[model samples]
Target: MSQLKYKRILLKLSGEALAGEGGYGIDPERVHELAQKIKRVRHLDVQVAVVIGAGNIWRGQIGMRHGMDRATADYMGMLATVINALALQDALEQIGCDTRVQTAIEMKAVAEPYIRRRAIRHLEKGRIVILAAGTGNPYFTTDTAAALRAMEIDAEVLIKATKVDAVYDLDPKVNPNARRYEHLTYLDALNMRVGVMDSTALSLCMDNDLPIVVVDLWGESSIERVVLGDDIGTLISS
Candidate 1:
């Protein structure tokens, strides 16, 4: 077996990804399949921490556009992430992987509140830690949450799993002529306004010198390939 490139990694998964092709809500089969892939990574002895988005259930920005207060909408979005995290925790455990869901907000009955030291201890003990709730505040996207968690956990890289294989000059689905980038620097992505990640998250990653790899989660073994150091997607770094 090839040596894994990353010792510890933070995986950012969108809430919609858990929905699979059905396009809404949690799909059991999809969750199980994702869990199995995660198990593969664990088998390689890599510490995994996941940060999931809540767009599938509720997007605070969208709710705000529809007349909801920004803070209230964001809180709702946080709850949505918690729901996804719990579901993923269950799935991972079903596959025999020890998992923990830590939230930014207090949810004692369901999960542990975000405690940096405790999360680190979990990773040290070989437990997959899933981070939910967007920074425990509003006006922030889960992309930012992933960056924040990656930093908190001292992860080697931020693995952003998306619907697309890589970052493109334009929406590939809408424009066939869109160019995909195999690699990029933080400034390159920022200057180009590449939508691979939010500007805030991108900037944070840049400042911390954390490399990010964006790849399609729907692709076969893409996550494992990435962890194994295969060239599979766009890599953004300083």
Candidate 2:
């Protein structure tokens, strides 16, 4: 029998992951590699729901800083996420993983509209569901969406997959002396303004008692390690 710590999980991947080392737009080869990593976890019978960001394409805050309307910039960011979601969906399906793409903004021509019950059903039937377009509204980050969806779907935990391996007291890259938090309470993260996730998202996870595991997706078998109960990165809870 497969021993799994969290049978159901919500993974938050930044659009930058798809951008790869080049740092902009979708890179097909990198997307395919990510799909393979996801496939490894799916075969473990883990029910996975992913929320991807739009930083690689466009960032609402960046647009707003340059004088774009706040709502308009955010909406554009949401659309960018949909593009990443579709690309990811294509990659996963190409690898023979049964998948479904659900968008919050309701693009029926491309994907099913996000329906809570229907999404849960897809997981129950062994399909990996990729959630796109953020919260279907402006002014929300994909991090918030991940927390919200994880709670709505009763995900055992939320995995914040990032370029960095763990939550550190300081930037590990910039400061060689920075120390990593082997574990933390969500309250600790928020109190210290730790950027494990955006403040709003962290608060949501804390209030609901949903644990989050911060791991580097670039690490070999990192996703699988998290699902199989191996300690590979920072763990935050409460």
Candidate 3:
């Protein structure tokens, strides 16, 4: 713990990450792998919080494009995040890691309601807290939720775990020659309009002076390395 740069961190993961090779739905093996990685981080005596998106189970945008009500679709997406959170909580528990699932929207049967003090207490007691339901509101992305929760919990850093190794000027998939940025200022990231995170999230982090790390989740011990201050990915800060 003395060697750790971040005593507490918020890991932001996409719903697609839990989809495995099929690119849809929860894959147990994938969830298990993610759990193992998280356990390793906890083993280092660091408090970990997670905010996962729901693109795989339900993409509200796709529904809205098909003429569905925006608020309804968003609410459905929020519920989908709860499903992912439960799956992740189960996996973490299976690995002998204590975890709690807190939802922004109340569903007492499945998870505890999101409460700032309770969540902080859980982390202090060495329990991983997985936050779900996207801020308990419509018209907000999970990215924004992660940002909000990170500040609410006074996290040392916000880790954006993604498939890509780092942030790039252009989509590396579309252009192989795109330049990757090892470090970026918050204003630079906001002006560039980085696709990995939304502007609202960026603005919130900027205002709060919270550092953001974009890293490849599958890289060998990548998440641990980030919290350990290894400079593993693109870091956005003031």
Candidate 4:
């Protein structure tokens, strides 16, 4: 067995990552596959916490552009995250992984309210914590929420699971010949205007010197490979 690189990791998954081939809404098989992937990580004896975004169901910026109130759009986006969280929790639990869905907004009937201590305790007890609701405030991206929670939980690294294989100089889809970055510094990602994460989240990670690994979530063993220290994707650090 390969040694685990990060004992505790916070995985940042975009809600669209849960969307399947069509790429517009929750896809059951895809979510279940993601669940099984996390199961593999847990089997590696790595504690995992996930922060899922709400782009699949609702993107506040797009809504606002369509003439919706900014705050209302953001709030709706938060609720969408909670929906994704619950779906993920169900998938994880069905696969026999002990999981908890905690939301920033109080929704006792659906999930436990996010409490820092309780979330940490869940990780300590070998359970997966799915953090939802985007920091419980408007105007904050889930990227920021993921960064904040990783810091709060003292996560060894923040693993960003995305559609792309690695970070590139341009949108690889648009530019087939884009140069890929196998390694990057937070400043490089920021100063270069690279979109590894939004500026606020990138700043937070840089401030704390937290390392980040961006991997393709669609890879068969990418999650396990990353936890086992395989050089599979772009690594942003320092």
Against the reference, the lDDT scores of all candidates come to 0.92, 0.93, 0.96, 0.91
- After the best TM-score superposition of candidate 2, give how far the Cα of residue 31 lies from its true spot, in angstroms: 0.1
Model 3 regions lying over 4 Å from their true place: none
Q: How many backbone collisions does model 4 have? A: 0
lDDT of 2 by residue, 64-98 (tens): 88999999998999999999999999999999999
Off by over 4 Å in 2: none
Top candidate, metric lDDT: 3
Error of 3 at 27 (Å): 0.5
Clashes of each: 0, 0, 0, 0
Comparing 1 with 3 on TM-score, the higher-scoring candidate is 3
List CA RMSD, all candidates: 1.1, 0.9, 0.9, 1.1
TM-score versus the correct structure, for each prediction = 0.97, 0.98, 0.98, 0.97
Question: What order do you get sorting by lDDT, best first?
Answer: 3, 2, 1, 4
Writing each residue's lDDT as its tens digit, candidate 1 over 154-188 gives 99999999999999999999999999999999999
* lDDT at 89, model 3: 97
lDDT of 3: 0.96
Scored against the true structure, residue 31 in model 2 reaches a CA lDDT of 97
Candidate that beats the other on lDDT, 3 or 4, i.e. the better one: 3
